[model samples]
Target chain A: MTDLSQQLAFVLEIDKLKAVYRQTTVKEDKDRHENSAEHSWHIALTAQILKDYAEYPIDIERVVQMLLIHDIIEIDAGDLFAFAEQQDHAQQALKEAQAAERLFGLLPPQQHEQYKALWFEFEAAESNDARFAKAMDRILPLVQNMNNNGGSWAKHKISQPQVLARNKHLEYIAPKLWQYVVQQTDLAVSNGWLKKD
Target chain B: MTDLSQQLAFVLEIDKLKAVYRQTTVKEDKDRHENSAEHSWHIALTAQILKDYAEYPIDIERVVQMLLIHDIIEIDAGDLFAFAEQQDHAQQALKEAQAAERLFGLLPPQQHEQYKALWFEFEAAESNDARFAKAMDRILPLVQNMNNNGGSWAKHKISQPQVLARNKHLEYIAPKLWQYVVQQTDLAVSNGWLKKD
Candidate 1:
């Protein structure tokens, strides 16, 4: 197939991301679950809006690209809940890796390398952009959970410590946002939406 | 307010993009209109997948970033339909410019500059990256119109020449994709999805 056709096919296929529901809900809209596509778009927009708070200055463009394609594998591997500990990690990783290869591989060779690298960089969370992106990824759902009266946290019986542990890396990546999270988690505890123990 | 709070505020606010519907519908799902957020995510993914088809060797990352943030002004300005001619051009441009300033200005100064500049680059459509991004932006809707049995094209009574004119720039930006589009338009015209005269 021509590169354009391949690309169009990929575009149509990845729309499935909209159907892959996540554990998080929209912060403003509590009526439904947020899909991976919406979450990815939100974080990309968030990365641009929040770049300054990162511990390191980042290439905002690269960070935006990472967020755009990062969760695409979820179209195949499915969204794993941050609190769901019942899954097999090795199997999930294997499925996602395969998903990444199949999905990113749908692009031309050079473009495929570009996105695959970005996904790896995001997963490793070592680069400055990746680190900042990771912080935004972790922080947003926490805020959503808090705002929606502990949303997924309440639904899953997620404890405050569980929330804190999942996002503790935010302190290193985005200190100020982590502070905001701490304040909100306390508020959530007081509101009886989050488990104190 | 601290930068993180501002960032979180911006993220929560931009969720409104999910509520902003576009003229296009998802190629896979025709029951509802595609939201601006989903459209942005789709084009960004399309940019990466089809970068090779660009007449110029473009910076795919920059193109992805542009597509991700380009429609965000729509959050404030609202989406303008490609076939809609009743709107005032100067007034629409003014609203979008103001929207760009307000929406992008939600970021820290540096990020605000980065995104504002990218948004302008996309609007100008002079850069290789922006040109390719524009082609993807145009092609998707055309495909969607084709997929949904003439969709807005039929609804708006859009002619083939009108469709051709709106997307003429694609020929210069992405020759191969433009060829694909020409072939599709021929099919569309024959099928009466697009008016021939």
Candidate 2:
């Protein structure tokens, strides 16, 4: 295959992401859930916009790219919703790592390596850029849950403690956004979006 | 407002793009159409994957960012289907300009200006980065049309001549990708996806 065909095929292959639906609804619409494709777009934009709040200075471009490719493996492994109570995350991670190898391996060699590296960095979430990008991903759904009549939170009967525990990493990576997260979680409790006790 | 609040608000506001669906559908599922947010994600990824095919070297990081922000103003002005015959593009452009002002205005001044400039650069499509990004945007729908049993092309009676005219810019930006574009168009014609005038 020619370079263009390889590139086009890779581009076409990732469109599978549009079919992978997640639990979070669009900000306004509760009847329909947002798909993984838009979820990736939202988090990438969130990373771009919130780079300033990272614990240390970062390459914003790298952070946003990391966020863009973060969940792409979900196209094969499927979207594992944050509030889902039954699934074993360790098992899911193993399946997704295998999925990443198959999907990203479709790209040209150099791009395959680059994307795999970014995917691993995002999974690690230890570097400053990945930490900030991880924070961006967490906050979007938190805001969505607050907006869509408590969205998945109320749907799953998620508790405030559960939500806090899941997203608390923001407090260190982005202190200012973390304040909003805490304030919103508190408001969610009073608003009955989360279980009070 | 602090930078983070401005950033969060900006990120949340753009979620409207998810509700702004487009003419193309997911590759296999004609049951639902694609959304603007995912369109951005697809094109941004395409830009990354095809960056090597660009006529000259490009700062791909900038190109991907430009692709990400290109259609965001459509969040307010709404998506303009390329084959739509009756819509007033001038009026739409005016509305989109105003939309850009309101949406990007939600961020701190530096980020606001940075995003606005990227948006305008994409619209102008003059720089090498912008040109390649524009090419990336155009081909996705063309390929989608071929994939979905002629998709919008058949629905809108889009012709081969029209597709060629709309996408001719690819010839100069990245000849290799443009070659795939032409071959796909030819194959599309033979496959009865486009009228053979």
TM-score of chain A of each: 0.93, 0.93
Q: Tell me how candidate 2 scores on lDDT.
A: 0.82
Task: Write one digit per residue (lDDT tens) for candidate 1, span B1-197.
Answer: 76666666667778878777887666544356778887888778677666667777888877877887888888888888887765566677889999989987886677778788998999988888888888888988887777679888988888888888878878998777777788899999999898897
Clashing pairs in 1: none
CA shift of A155, model 1, Å: 2.9
Tens digit per residue, CA lDDT, model 1, A1-197: 86666667677778778777887776544356777887888788777666667776688888887888889998889888877665666677889899999998987677778789989999888888888887778888886666677788888887889888867767887787788788888999898888997
The prediction achieving the highest lDDT against the true structure is 2
What TM-score, to 2 decimal places, does chain A of model 2 have? 0.93
- Any runs in candidate 1 off by more than 4 Å, and if so which? A27-30, A56-60, A88-90, A124-129, B27-30, B56-61, B86-90, B109-114, B126-129
DockQ of 1: 0.52
Provide TM-scores for the models. Answer: 0.87, 0.93
Off by over 4 Å in 2: A85-87
Residue A83 CA displacement from its true place in model 2, Å:
3.5
